[model samples]
Target: MMRVGVISDTHLRSYDRDLAKKLAEHFKDVQMILHAGDITELSVLDMLEAPQVIAVLGNMDGFAAAQSLPAKRELKLEGFQIGLIHGYGPPNGLEERVRREFDDVDAIVFGHSHKPTNYLLNGLLYFNPGSAAGGRGHPKTVGMLTLGDSISGEIIEI
Candidate 1:
């Protein structure tokens, strides 16, 4: 099985050692890491302890982060296709907006609402690990995806 770590909405202007340490512990076993966006700086990505790190540009990202990342991306892993994006607009209906961005994918990973969501709908897996930095009364969280015979997700409070 392949394991992947998912996180978003860090909103950090610089490196956060404490956050990094937490991520290192929570995501220690993952082979890849996905940052759904709102990462204000690129240094934040370095905290993840994974072989592969994929990320997108969120509305709140700074100029350098925006230039280094895409608004959306796709990946093919363990026979499943996955889409990653940083959602936009209001929290309500944020899933629908991100859903419209990709096609023929088994799952969509996104962040923007700072809400943790993991469920299967219409054969698609919609996952949001919430905000790792914690904001707006939401508890800090992250996510894990295990890919084998099928794909499954787990939201981890950090």
Candidate 2:
């Protein structure tokens, strides 16, 4: 199986040692890492130690971070098509907005609402790992996806 670690809305302007430690512990067995955005600084990405790292630029990202990353990304992993986006607007319509963005994806991973979600809708999986920095009154958390013959995921509190 391929294990993937998912995170978003870090919103840290600098490297966070505590976060780094938490990542190491939580994602120790993950083969890849996906950052959904609001990363704010490139240093945050640099601190991650994963075989592969995929990220998108969030609305709150600074010039450097924005310039270095795409606003959206489509990746094929373990026979599944996954769309990664930072998302936009209010939480209510966020899923509809993302659904319209990608035409042929098996799953969509996003963040912006600072809320965790893992649901299957019309045969598509909509996943949001919430805020790793605990924004919007939610507790800090991350996500994990195990892919093989079937795909399954879980939200892990940090």
User: lDDT tens digits, residues 29-78, model 2?
Assistant: 99999999999998899767799999999999999987889999999999
State TM-scores per candidate.
0.98, 0.98
Q: What is the C-alpha lDDT of each candidate?
A: 0.93, 0.92
Q: Model 1, range 41-94, lDDT digits (tens) per residue? A: 888888878999999999999899878898999999999999999999998899
Error of 2 at 71 (Å): 0.5
| Candidate 2: stretches off by over 4 Å | none
What residue pairs are clashing in model 1?
A: none
Model 1: per-residue Cα lDDT at residue 151: 95
Which run of 10 residues does model 1 get worst, by summed lDDT? 40-49
Highest lDDT: which candidate? 1
